[model samples]
Target chain A: MSANPEPRDPAGETLLSAAELEARLQQIGRERYHSLHPFHKLLHGGRLNRGQVQAWVLNRFYYQSRIPIKDATLLSRCEDLELRREWRKRIEEHDGWPAGAGRERNEGGIERWLVLAEAVGLPRDYVVSTEGLLPATRFAVDAYVHFVREKSLLEAVASSLTELFAPKIHEERIAGLLQHYPFANERTIAYFKRRLKEAPEDVKFGLAYVIREARTRAQQEQVLAAVRFKTDVLWAQLDALHHAYVEPGHVPPGAFVPEGPQEWQASA
Target chain B: MSANPEPRDPAGETLLSAAELEARLQQIGRERYHSLHPFHKLLHGGRLNRGQVQAWVLNRFYYQSRIPIKDATLLSRCEDLELRREWRKRIEEHDGWPAGAGRERNEGGIERWLVLAEAVGLPRDYVVSTEGLLPATRFAVDAYVHFVREKSLLEAVASSLTELFAPKIHEERIAGLLQHYPFANERTIAYFKRRLKEAPEDVKFGLAYVIREARTRAQQEQVLAAVRFKTDVLWAQLDALHHAYVEPGHVPPGAFVPEGPQEWQASA
Candidate 1:
């Protein structure tokens, strides 16, 4: 009966001031980040058991594996060589150079993640296979990849702006795991420790890119929504984990069956 | 260190009998369908208040609108015009024939869904705009379209086997809604009324296609996996709804917030 409403802009609203925009962005991060999720609280507070922690690591590896692929998609679409030069570093950081392309072979984030997965007692091969992922995990992470591929370049960069809020979660995660979980150590939880080093640089580039480019209120709203969408992406994964693993009898068929209470005693 | 494991067939396992395959498919549906989701249980049992029902209608409208598009994608890929001819009827059933076509204009499923939405007190304009949708709803529905687009033809067709299990849910939905809710009129719930007539033929054709064509054990497994994936697609949408709406205080920042408990006391 009615048409799709055109995004109504008021008569003469001006662009957001830089300080105001940054504050609003920070406000979104502080309120909506996955660090606030109860599942994360359980994990970081050492309230989760061994299998519950393994469920998180195994399911999370799927997300970790896809990051470089998403970055490559970003690089393919970018027109700026300088931006591409900066962005491609992300791909190598996730997916190390394959021993040949005129670069030294070194480990990347994905291998580091597998090491964490292995340390957490998920077989590295099983982690790589991704056969144990929650179905929602696949849908949520694939949705992120598609969002990067389909949304505007600005939104793609903006989605990664969740990194602006990542350092604190990483710091807490490292300390909590080290303090509580037995499998966790300086070496076992190296990925989070390394992320303290990697994520800030990513956040700096992504935050500045969005802040500089999202000039109009409409574009700024899209940036905010993208950041929100990314949080939902992270939050949804934890929701699936909590529903399937923490909550009894809810995991759909074929998802990983963590050995909680009965099968695997509380070893962690 | 190891190869991607070839799907191991036990040394002497043979193709399943058609009856066994059908039973397995039914077993999957029994266990995994959206009818089993608590959100649907609450909905059919008339426990959700006005805003909660409105949230369901609004978010589900996005999925309804995309059905014809996914169906069209399936038709475009089918080399068999016979299959295309059969599938095009589905597109018309959802999208409806235009007024100028030789056939008299009859309302299709999407418009009928809007009417159901209107009957439940959501303004048709708001439902049409779909600005109130859960981000997970968009991702899950869009993933269905992508699954149809990207998977093999048999798998694409097989993903639709959820329809095999749909009629019972539709029957229950129609009966439950008419029995429990105030807005129960034959005209208002016409969408589900129509689907009971439409889906059986679809199930017949699709069932035969998978059973007749999936001659080998491996192909049968793919069919089974596709059906399970489809179930997850539907289940994930409800999981999102239940997480955001059924559970208190978990709705993401921009999703539809239903009037329930304190705001709109139980008036269903």
Candidate 2:
């Protein structure tokens, strides 16, 4: 992300209070968050047809599936045991716990995303294969994983600060999908539901870490920029979705071409 | 690129002859290259407005500037001194020869691209800063660099096979820009002109290397897939340009927004 360091923002205020920094970060969400994108508006308002919805589900799975990998990448870079232990939860959350630790099976967020994919009439294998994804989607998701791998741990943790804003989107997604699409039963919408429960705990840790670790104005700026960069990652995916599947729609060769009107298919 | 291994192509043919492998590679370029993209058609056919052209030039600078880095990365992975000697030319060609070697200063492909940007009324500093680039552009370009870094040396070399089809595009661009856009002068289009001279040599070596190195059917498949991946990297960039600068264009926030109709400003 810092391939281009932006000229510093012109707020001549020297050091930011934790409260001041939180306000600035939230301000980024208020203005630059993915919810403000037209595609999300089309999505939430029931304006998208079944095909567009299916395209979103298929493409978004790439991001969903990468969550654990990105978290693991972050955890690999952190030396602190506390941070590593907390971060391990993200990997487990997406990838799910393994067999027989004396607990019920957890299929994790990714399998839940696949269930949603099935609801939208896409086969789970096709969604997992990601061969149908827009090159733009792959690029955006990979850039994100790469960002977490390469950026400072401060910036990497800051990137996840978008989660600070995620619960709202998940809430909206839950309501919107249920209201607009026939396929959105509790079983299919489980990913967003689970995220709503998971993210606040994650965000509480991340925001505190970013605010505490930033200690200097420059670090705060990097933290802020990392959040902005993550928004770009999220936003660019929808831009690709809109461009390919929405107005003047030209699905790039090999991306998922929405089939004839989709009928809800239960995940096996 | 291989996060999801594509089910192998079902061709039962054993190993391919050099000519047969070359045919398959050309097939990818013919069917999937950026030249086939609508935005490129708009570009070469002179349908895009000046601002659109500026946006393309600005965003493309990210790709242009990263070439040397990508080449250097490939070289770092390669152990064979002969291969390293051959690959070093790519870095030198893109980065240009240093002055201490008793040669004229060649500011390289990136500088030439900025000249093109300046011809379309962008400032050199701003274009070089990449501040105004579409996040989509950054993602696509960074993904390419990342692929070269992480993938096998054969795959990395294979990715550069797009240069095999470069001459035609260069020829078309030179003639098309000069014929249609007022900004298209020899100085402004110097990048394409220079690449026409440089690419054949690079392609000759890269193509021969890929053809010779892929000794098995599986290796050949990876080589072919690498080229396909390269094409996607390119086509996605144009997809982004069209989405943001073409019809129903909502330039994603933080991308280069085309300005008031451009009047060419000669690079100083």
Candidate 3:
């Protein structure tokens, strides 16, 4: 197989109208994104044994910690105040307000994410510091930042269209976790709850921005490509996790290793 | 492992003196660079049969095509004309001049590399277009370019210190290819012969630049780290190739596959 798919007859025809394009984008998420990834299914299904669950939470914390910074990078690059103001909400959502504003309420998404980490039995410092996340996770996330920095503004905005499909997946994931994991509860899953609400607004703004702005066929194609790249980013992380924690057990040296029965106490 | 190694101990004794650092860096190349990688061993040892060698040349062309562009990026960023002039030689060495007074009669390293591609049965147009290279090769090479752009100048120069070790590897690779592959001869291996002389001068300039500029202990460590990062860049390309082309054969969906019979075709 060629590393890239044979260039389809991209010029053949418009496969979908604007409305259909939007649905096709969502369909891509339904079929290909992390929610459908086997590791994620195993995660939400509670089929992952305890060690696998620990691995998921530990690896995911790396992604969570980088969200605000990635958003802030986007925030830094936007010249228009309207765009900046809209984007600032994402950073604010992750970072919350400074202490003692009385407005400085409970912790933000990052902190809530830590609660999920603790619920899964990972140490707070290790989780917060992201000391043991997979290298593939770091590489994938860095690739996203590079895309945003290097690609056109339309494509950068389009890449964030992953948010468009997020609310639905967020719903499924939360419901699945609650149904399957006794350790998971409404309180522990608060991060997904907030995202379920936040994602729709973000996605609505971003999709409108992309649809209106991606004027040329090439630009429209880039929009689709960006979302595809983002999907791969999410999918690759799960693939690495499955390869490491599930089949064949050929984890790279220095990645997280689950402690066996005797070693479990020492790690604990 | 931690994506980044922990900061080295402040008081850790020096592993190599200034001169010894040069020797150890060369030693690392001797033991670990891609020339020593099993994929190269197969290619140079005549063990790959034919289609595999074509795949090797096709994938490697991506690396060859990027070197001058990477050097040009480094040149563009340097403020000093002397530094730029010194660096410009690398670009010239790889790209050659375009029909000018000092222009060499032959095409550049890129053109020479295509001879290997032709010898191994890949079309020159396909090789030059780089449509067939692995995604991992592009990612790794781009990562190296970004590293040079973002790093301190001393560290950036240090990254090219890999050249210091390249001469030995080039010699070994050349001899190995000539002895083992009946289709490979002086003309087919012209690229390595050019690199044999070019790499040492480039290495000397880079090493002296790094040693003279890396005054503090922290800066020295950064230089060392830069070399290691560059080594990883080269190492990862081979790792990706090995995994995709060799054992387990779980080639990613669209990567290149050998066509027709496995035996070498007689050169025209």
Q: Which candidate number would show the highest TM-score if scored against the true structure?
A: 2
- For model 2, state the Cα shift of residue A6 in Å: 24
Residue-level lDDT of model 2, residues A204-236, one tens digit each, is 999999878886788999999999999999999
- TM values, all candidates: 0.87, 0.92, 0.78
TM-score evaluated only on chain B, model 1: 0.89
Please list the residue runs of candidate 1 whose C-alpha ends up more than 4 Å from where it truly belongs after superposition.
A1-13, A97-105, A211-218, A260-268, B1-20, B98-104, B212-217, B260-268
lDDT of 1 at A104: 74
Runs with alpha carbons beyond 4 Å of true place in candidate 2: A1-13, A98-104, A262-268, B1-13, B98-105, B262-268
Candidate 2 chain B lDDT trough over 10 residues, lowest sum = B4-13
Docking class of 3: incorrect
Give the lDDT of residue A51 in candidate 1: 85
**Which residue segments of model 3 deviate by more than 4 Å?**
A1-16, A27-61, A97-106, A113-137, A165-197, A235-268, B1-16, B23-56, B98-103, B128-133, B175-183, B247-268
Lowest lDDT 10-residue stretch of candidate 2 chain A: A4-13
- How does model 2 fare in lDDT? 0.87
lDDT of 3 by residue, B1-268 (tens): 4553333335553433578667766666765556656667776676777766777788778888888878888887788787898999888877766776875575778888988898877888888877656655666677777777787777778888888778777878898878777678889999999988788888878888876676566777788778767776776566556655654443443457777888766655
Report every candidate's CA lDDT.
0.84, 0.87, 0.73
Per residue, candidate 1 scores C-alpha lDDT tens digits across A42-102 of 9999898878899999989999999998999999899988789989989878876667768
| lDDT, residue B83, candidate 1 | 85
TM-score of 2: 0.92
- True C-alpha contacts between chains kept, each model in order: 0.38, 0.87, 0.00
Q: How well is candidate 1 docked (DockQ)?
A: 0.44
Worst 10 residues of 1 chain B by lDDT: B259-268
